[model samples]
Target: MEALQSVYIPGSRFLPTKRNMRMKAIDSEVQHSIRRIVNNRIKAMKAEEGNYDDLLGVMLESNIKESRAREEILNVLGDQNVDTDGLNQLKVVNMIFYEVLRLYPPFVGIARKADKDITFEGFSLPSGTQIALPIILLHYDEQLWGSDANKFKPERFSEGISKATKNQVIYFPFGWGPRICIGQNFALLEAKIALTMILQKFSFELSQSYVHAPHIVLSLQPQYGARLILHKLQ
Candidate 1:
């Protein structure tokens, strides 16, 4: 619970303060979804090939810098804690989440219905055939995203999601509106808090033994395993 940089919080300690609750409405659903993904994804990776240390690093950092904020919430959400600051400050966590999702889409493919009729590049499409939105097409789009679109670049999100997507539909790590990922806020909050803690304490990288193939079973996941190493902080 010690302060890492001696940077005191901006507000006073006496009044009944209110934390940012932007994602409060979607907390439950987001919690469930996050749990399923982390658990399943971790399990999918081979035992020796996975990086539990990365998670450890996050925990250490959270312990050192955040204390009361993330820890208390951790009690309620188990290991996950939804925090304020929205998703902007969550660049690193977002990267981890993106890497996880890109490697393992929760739904893989999207299903949609036609309103009437539609046309493609030069073909006429009918209105009845249920169409599938290939998530990978956008997730790995070289045109929309750059060549490293397939690579993990948390810096891309450092400025904002708009910059990452070039303000296009290429970045739907979460989904599009009306029925977009409802719990996105909650999940993101949790991811931010968790990742903030982790990054603050340790550094990490993929191990040489790690594989590149991601498979889709219930979600997109590593076919072999995800291996990474972490170094603890003072």
Candidate 2:
């Protein structure tokens, strides 16, 4: 853990080759942890009965119209007071994911180098200059997200991404423009599916043992761990 923490220090690369070796070890552990979580979710899904009426079912059935799918889902869940349809519920899930990303982006910062001289606003940058684009800084800016920028509020995204921020550039959790993450949609869908399945079977809340500290290595994660008290639903 100490070695992993050291890797986050600025200019840590200037250290000895032994330090680089430690980084590889920490990275491997991180990768293994992620794979374990994904594999467990996949195994659980596969073990489920073929008859599913939730989000996964909709996905598996394929080619259903958005509104029709929502209707089917609402029927399966027996939820009448929701007022909103399945599509809107999906939107709410997406917004929740967006809020999570805003608080803790996977790539906290991305670097870009200037190929030639350029001017933006009133500032000038010469060729061969490197720029650090700290996306998390923009994600939490008061001007873009209002007074509650630091707090978790998925409702802020109810209107959609374009209208959520003061400027479009302030909300790039997966990078922006042509250089954006190619697997962004896939990643989000994977998360959405897993979250849906979990929510379907269980209700959960933070346990007394839960810690709120978020630490960043390659990605943001709970420093102590996310301890939750879960209750299985009928």
Candidate 3:
């Protein structure tokens, strides 16, 4: 992919080359088209009173809805510091984390090698063949996650990961199987603790200048960085 190449190939983005210029033009066009489509959709939604029933419509209809998550955390831990037991009880918070990770997985992809010759979906590959799994693509796949896959509906994980993924290899923010990240639980626990502490004292929203630009270096990151305005709770 050109985007991947731009990141992996040294000096490709900065070099004044034909390929780089073409990529930039293509990227600009894609951005402009996406912006136009979204703006048109917003305008259409405003002009209509009918139900949307699509991803964009759902997103526009959805509200912050963080009160439930905050209330769940408060009920589980009150003003106390987050503990393992309390963290486990914060179901809504856990769902929010799962949804966030699904949308913005830290790693865009994962690499693996076939230990032995294998046949998959009519393709036969010899041993030692390399495979690259695109996590972001899989996460956003409509067939795997239904039509509203792009929306931030955390309730999908309400019944747990198994139900959310239909007992498939579709969802894996920290990779899957035996080679899954060993620190997955620890990392999530750390995040839960930090989030719990913050929610206990403040409410936050995106700042006016915040720009949503998810880019991948080694891992997925916000290109412009996330800017938030936090309000202290009295």
Candidate 4:
């Protein structure tokens, strides 16, 4: 854990220290292990046509059964290209995106510096004090999001962001206020369009080779990469 933490320390990779070299070696070994696991799973899948009742298998099965977002997309857009008007009508897709962002935010945290002396929640903060807000922690907070905070429930944003967050600043996947991400709308629109296109012509499932090891470098991502089995729709 210490070694892993050291890898993310600013300028650690640029240094010629022995500790950095050891960390790099450890990272390589970890990657090798992940590759082996993926290869073994692929071999197992190829060897048999039997049903997999593993945790991921069961979860995937459940997701397949429960998800109606694709159906909504098909109904809304049909075979036509996604447009701004059609995109606006995709309530379900938007909700799913919001839920996804809430669960797996692109950036794990946000950094800000205090411009002036101020008191927040009774604590006094001087100017130039750098603060790091862990967005994932707030995202999964049970107190703010109820008991199923960690669970994937897109319906939370069915009414809209204001209602879902009760107009609080707790939910800010793309940051909040004036300094919020300028490309937030464009990014979501682009994602919605791309996802709409994909769902229109393909059905996908998590491959048995998929390993759910999410880690953060600059952003939250699958440590070993996301492996999926895509089947084209008729």
Candidate 5:
């Protein structure tokens, strides 16, 4: 949501396109984010198992492992690897996930079909008309997020979803409704595992050349590549 806004909303100084372009921009971000999240999980799994097939291990083994599977779930443990801690330990990691969402929301807009004609903002929109919800605009709505909406802040979500969204239907990075992402659970779990491992292992800083420029093709990608420096941990 915030990420999509980074492209169109005024303060961000990004240009806007029609609704379809916005939707594509968001989907591209989502697909790229998912791949990186999965790969990171793979790396983390290897740290324990030496080899990891991830979900396959859970799906095929859960029936055999039963309730023990949750105990063995590393991603849920937050900062602690599954072997060292349990879901009770994952507060910080969850917070990080929320921040990632703020910085790189996966979708720009959501399209819906109107069941009946409706008057909106004073205009009569006919029935069967499609309504586009510009997630980018709602997310950066300062009235809802405060002036710091553009700034990266994980503490905003620390109070949880209601506080983060101001109890509105605005902050939908994975979308909403019955057709919402089925793999949301899998993707989130994977992201936590990967992000945790990366944080645990390194410290990073953006290079002098790094710039906050994004482009819209299918996804709002960094127009300039993400050039940064990572220092390995001892």
Candidate 6:
């Protein structure tokens, strides 16, 4: 139900409404089945013999580093009792992801159907009409992002998401509003943890053969696959 509702399918919205009790029941069953499968896979992982260094392990390691950093900060201040929950020393990692999202959002555009007639910016939109929101264009607009809009500037997000641009609405890589993607937080946290682990383990740069063109087929992707030269850290 979650995946179907989010993905652009033929009749997703029309399928499992309050009026369609039968379909709703089926949807619930499908969701349960997916959860059961995921739990089983986790159990299988726990049952395995060999050691594995995965995202969860990496996050656990990061948690230890965070504790140490917190203690160091407390020692410097001579106040060990101060709360450290609000501190975020890993904010730079977040900025890197923000810049990546600005340059190449997962979805090039999102479609919305208008149920009623509306007028905006001197343009009229009739009822029962569909519109494609050009997200990347808005993301890269110089008016909002300043003269260096074309450049990859992760430092822009150092002050936080709200201050990243003059108009905060312009940065909606996960879409916006009540109908925004349900898994937005999950996706962001996953990316942050993965990027943090990668940076900790290796140094990497774009390969000489790398291509920069981006295209979309359902979701935005590189026209040619990204090539990187990774050097492992000891």
Identify the candidate with maximal lDDT.
3
Off by over 4 Å in 6: 1-88
C-alpha lDDT (0 to 100) for residue 164 of candidate 4: 97
lDDT of 1 by residue, 1-234 (tens): 333655566753333434224344367679999888666545443242333346643333333323433343334343333446343544445555665565356677787876678897896768876877777777777777677675544446656667667787765656676779889888866766666666556556567687779787777778887886877755
Question: For candidate 5, what is the lDDT?
Answer: 0.62
Off by over 4 Å in 4: 1-62, 65-67
Can you write out model 5's per-residue Cα lDDT over 1-234, one digit (the tens) per residue? 756565564543343546557877888999999888766655554453422234544332222222222223434643455333453356655655665665566676779987898998998989899888877677777887898676545557778878788688878777789878898888877765665566555555567696768666665578888886777756
lDDT tens readout by residue for model 6, 1-234: 655577566765577566467767888999999788656545554454312256443333334333333343434333322223422455655676688899899986788988899998998999988999899998889988997687655668878888887556898889898889899878877765555445545556566686768888788888898887778756
Cα-based lDDT for every prediction: 0.59, 0.69, 0.83, 0.82, 0.62, 0.67
lDDT measured at residue 145 in model 5 versus the true structure, 0 to 100: 86
Q: Please, what is the TM-score per model?
A: 0.52, 0.62, 0.73, 0.73, 0.58, 0.60
Candidate 2 structure quality by residue, lDDT tens digits, 92-132: 56777788899889888899998999998898999988999
Query: Would you give me the overall lDDT of model 4?
Result: 0.82
How many residue pairs clash per model? 3, 0, 0, 0, 1, 0
- Per-residue alpha-carbon lDDT of candidate 3 for residues 64-155, written as tens digits (9 for 90 to 100): 33666788888988998778889888888889899999999999789999999999999998999999999999999999999979877788
Clashing pairs in 5: 78-90
Report the Cα lDDT for residue 87, model 1: 38
Ranking by lDDT: 3, 4, 2, 6, 5, 1
TM-score of 5: 0.58
